[model samples]
Target: MTKRHQLALATALVAALALGASGCSDTKKGSAGGGAGGVNPAAANDGLTIGGTPAKGGTLTVLSNQDFAHLDPARNWVMPTMDFGTRLLYRTLVTFKAEPGKGGSELVPDLATDLGTPSNGGRTWTFTLKEGLKYEDGTAIKAADIKYNVERSFAPDLTGGPDYAAQYLAGTEGYKGPLQGKHLDSVKTPDDRTIVFELKRPVAEFSATTTLPTFAPVPQAQEKGPLYDARPFSSGPYKIESYDRDKKLVLVRNEHWDPKTDSVRKAYPDKFVVVMGLKGGQIDDRIIAGEGADASTVEWANMRPESAPKVLPKPEIKKRLLAESQGCTTMLNLNNSRAPFNDPKVREAMQYAVDKEAVVTAGGGPALTEVATSYLPPALAGGKQSDPLKIAPAGDPAKAKELLKAAGKEGLKVTFSVSTGDKGRAEAIQQGLARAGVEVVIDTVDPGAYYDVIGDLSTTPDMSLSGWCPDYPSGSTWLPFVFDGRTIKPKGNQGNNSQFRDDATMKRIDEINAMADAKEANQAWRDLDVAIMAKSPSVPLFLERKPLLVGPNIAGAFGHPVWVGQIDYATVGLKDPAKSQG
Candidate 1:
């Protein structure tokens, strides 16, 4: 069966399970256990009690286990909560428009009044900003602000400065050297409301690029340095009021926001609060205890059949299993520059030794069928191609042994570096490799240090466990960022940790990049996938399943195509038991 069909079947099974489980609940119970009961009327006005009805002026507390290393959009990567700050505080010019067969919800224009078509041979793009736009501090947002923010992303001192930003604006007349820390010659603000960008080559994903938070316009007059980090000047519907590290983050409605007249709905909660550092078990306890209401992120493995069924009362706190389109495919990236892995047969043998299904199933959740045939996930809209890698049929231990013996690297001492925070996951992987006769040395480090070490490709351990969620919903985001040798550096680029180098793959990537049409571009992406898979530089493991638990009142809380964590905050409302079924 096709991978798409397989995903469809998986989704159907999960949905059916949810329906069956929820149907067994008692409807007449006034105070539904597990925080399903309607909010207290008096508490609604005070905004102090969880599960209270919507009030125009109360703090909505949220909890996150991780802390933001940097609030700057360019540096921030983790999502659901990280995005809360970005989406609430900053506004991007061109948002995604809803497109069919693209996996999830489509993108539409967010801040731009109207999106312009490419001109000057697909190199120049002109955007018209909406009139009367104002920043949170009441400064008029002009076209100049957009130009400055885009230029700032290429600044030398910034932690997450994008190399591609320079290339995108390379051909423009004014902003030429900023990417290289010289005078810019490419970006131009032609008028008060007009901003034009010139590119070195035709960029097909230019519109989608605008959705990036780094492109969000910041006031030119806003103070720089430490003050900028503490006090963020923003234009979105909500503004950060206060943040207490490890406790809570409070946000208040931007009074300047006009939901209906401003095109889209403003932030729903009068005040938004995010509770910090709650453990996975603590989150489940809170949900069952009827203390915390609204959404919380859960690790899929932690929410297994045995644990979840016991922790959560069967019918009240209903488990809404969401199959994330963006697969978090974990793999062991080999440093081919090193011995043993330098040989293709050795790498191929190692790939054959791995049981992808066993690893995936052990990780818990559903049995993943659409396993990684390549670097890109199979369900990704445009990434449907045959893997070029000659993988051993199912479980071929005999062939694996033969290949390893032929390479004369039968007993190689391989060290597998695993992150410390996720010890259960790390141990599972270590045990799996051991079964295949691979001498696995587990090098455990803290999550933060682990990421830092991996980022520096020169210091990368022989084989390191790594995973990726797409920056955007395309195979282009996956391949070039991870496998393309051009991006792999002594200090890694955004995603290329594998440090893979191949002339044939690079040639195919260039061909796909040159293809102008979207359909043609997608086909080229598939061809590139085939080339990368054959090398076995990295083994595709499993797609992560994000289980979101929401109250019945919360509607349209599923995943979107581009935006990772945005629920329709505007339309979501408290349902009245008098008018609706329990």
Candidate 2:
């Protein structure tokens, strides 16, 4: 079985076992609207404004988790937090529109006016740059800069660039050569405004690559040293004024930025501040005391009605909450390459023992029923409320016992590995699995050691709890990384740490990948879910919902799965005129 298949099975099992819990109302409230009290339609408008007016010039103070680990986008593959930092310092050729739709938000031109079609049989792509664009230091952004960024992303030493680049751009004549230390064949800069890309094979999702930060243009002059890390010099609406590492991040308006030309309207606050390291309860207390920070990202459980008084004024503060469908799915990854889990029946039996709903309820919040049916979440696959993938697993101890007996592994002793960070959820999982007659031991480890040990297939654990945050909103990402045969650690090893591999399932995955349209892709993803359900590799846990708290003074603060940490610093503004003047 491929790593993808194992991940899929693990996801399914976690979902099945975690099926016995519930919580708050799951209503279809649209993307978070802006306002002081109640949804403000105008505040959510794309044409940005500060304190209801287009005001530029002011330092926005932001509190983040930590200083970005890497300044270079190519070497960084984490989500919006890291992406947010890079975006301030760089700009992508194309970016998803800041709206909701079938494509979530279709790819629209960012640095480029429009993405050109391939000149030769969909093998070559041409990009025409917008006129008068400049780097932060006043140097013109040119085709050469874009070319350099692309080539650098695929450089031999940079292992952090999205692995998909190697698969998609590898065929581009010059691009393939660079992969093996040979000169690139497909990348070329014809003029200052024009750049072209040649691929070895026709890929329908090629445009998607342009949305990645690695494809964002970088000035050749600033390529050397730790310049990118110092502060942002990109053409974005806001520039990084200062970065104080753990304390704060300050963003100032770019006077050179033209609001009309730029899709985002500049609503620079006098100061936007992010207060980091505060617990959810502490945030509530501070808000109640009228000492709460300007903006913050809080876990969903922390945003209960009880905590509202602390965060919001009794009569005036309005809460606008937006729940984005995350590409992430929490699950228990079993080391199939090891004992106990090496028996397929033992792994399958555990699936029958888990109660997912209970876990969701314990997490505190709404009863999110769209549990993990596959490695990919339902939202990405365009799943409806009535979708079969939403079905919960029937917890049957008898069936689990029978499955264990069938595999001649009646009494299996296994240690369940989970990180200390997930104390509440992991303990619940350990307790739930014990009902299946398995001697499940709970092994807790630090966050760093947890990830390091799990990734090492040679040192596989019996069962481990893991979660996946998608690189993008795509099933291809979830499937291949977790289950693809090629991703396995050792040769001929299917990377199915659960030691569960199925030839038939791998064939189905190929079919899913071949589908061209969204509808086809959605159906293929559902079918893949069903296949994974039958073969349990790991158990799916609950889908996570992150809740955020914003001060009443802050406006235009919205949430997105892509924008995790920062709350759109460029647009968010303080309502108080006094605070606006800071």
Candidate 3:
């Protein structure tokens, strides 16, 4: 959900369709190989593979430019961090399948016995824990642990995670989190094995939301509050052995993790060593070179666009490339509650002022970006929706000017807050707005502090570069998380950054949630998107196709559609253990 970087519609739509497919099958032809360059996708695997039955022992190295923002599940909201934590450090009630292609997005049981059973007209959900579920230290995982973690997420101190629990859970209107010695009656554990959620509204697709890290179990006894971000108690295949903040994090296999209880993770590698605070260019060069130790490395960050030219021409390195649809849409979030934007006409004008082609070029050209038309990318968009604003890909400056003139804000000046790394994109936006007779003052923030700065409502500027990918591939995940008025907070996690708190829109969200037919609900969500964009809450920028590079000796490498198009950590292993830093 972070503004990182983005797509073809038909191809990307096919990839998104894979995630919506249910049951024990991965039959769809997804977006893994559909890039502009001749970087073919890897062969499909049955939700699990390491080029065959993967070897059991080796150390897999993960090279990254920066450290994880938050390891605490409650504070985890970004894509790459969730990808790592959900796959390695924690276990949720249900997780998407780890297979390549369509199967990789299917919902599968992890700690829970199965996808939860819903009753009370879908207002109540019940999940039974799989027998023998244990934490890294071999303590039993009880249903109460799940309820406790859910309650902890509501803590005022723990912010930035998904707000689904607070939005839906009944009797939690003003409930402070469990840290205050008060427990949530809405999340009930009738027995050690059974857990029930009493929701205020009927939500048919609630199980998919459980895949989020917020739903991961955290035993209250070991909970360290804010300090837990340093190292969360592990319930998955690996536990933290040592973590030195921005330097490095070494993980060893948790012997207590029962593979039988986990249907998703392969856990092929005995250890994982994450090398952080390295330069992106250095990480890219090392993996492409595939030297000693580097031979068994994979990247936590995507390969830089600058490296594509150096590596693409070589047939040897091209095969190691993983380019796929991330199922994400990058956009500019205009603060709706603030002046200039508070006027709907001014917000509408900003949408027409964006030259997507220029923005796409700054975002690394056609291969990496598709000029977006809706907040829901074409993949989950069902079908092509109308461009109500009559948007031109190159931008309709005249239309923007007309709207600005009508609003009496024709030479509108606004501050654009963007990450230092994304200066090019901000400049392109500045130019595009200038053509529409709007002057933009560029405010560059450090890349590391960008989200935290903009996420705070008091410090947020007039406009900021923002993006969203679904928690899962449903409109339910898309619309509610980004546009729901209730998600807006004063200090942390301004999920609805636009701050468009229309009572009608919020009512429609509840209406769509109540629909039992997935197809009907999906179409309704699409229609609602058209209605919302008409208000111009934010500008739709582009859909993304991510390019990931891996070392030659790295096995089971695939661009996980559900994991922000990064290499799947759980299934990855070392082809030659001797070549690894074992």
Each candidate's number of clashing pairs is 25, 47, 6
- State which candidate has the highest TM-score: 3
Instruction: Report how far off residue 165 is in candidate 1 (Å).
Output: 1.8
What's the candidate order when arranged by decreasing TM-score?
A: 3, 2, 1
Estimate, for each residue in 1-582, the C-alpha lDDT of model 2 and write its tens digit: 111211222222223222311111222112111111323221121122212432343433443334555546555565554346434556667765543223333556777888566556556677888887876666788887777667666665554555555666645433432334354456678799887887655544556667676677766565543345455356665566666665656665555655565564345464444445555555544443434333322222224435533322223332433234444566777776657776667777777766654554344422222344455554455543112333343356677778888888776777776666455556666666666677777777776566556666665578876666555556666655556545666433322445445677677666666554545665666667656755667766645543344544455554444433224433455545354334
- In candidate 1, how many Å is residue 90 off? 1.8
TM-score for each model = 0.77, 0.78, 0.83
Clashing pairs in 3: 6-368, 6-544, 6-545, 7-369, 7-370, 47-99
Candidate 2, superposed: residue stretches over 4 Å from native: 1-59, 100-104, 115-123, 155-161, 171-183, 225-227, 264-267, 270-325, 365-370, 383-394, 490-523, 564-566
Give the per-residue lDDT digits (tens) of candidate 3, residues 197-230: 9988788778888988888999999888888888
Q: Model 3, residue 524: displacement in angstroms?
A: 2.0
After the best TM-score superposition of candidate 1, give how far the Cα of residue 182 lies from its true spot, in angstroms: 8.8
Q: So what's the TM-score on candidate 3?
A: 0.83
Each prediction's Cα lDDT score? 0.53, 0.52, 0.77
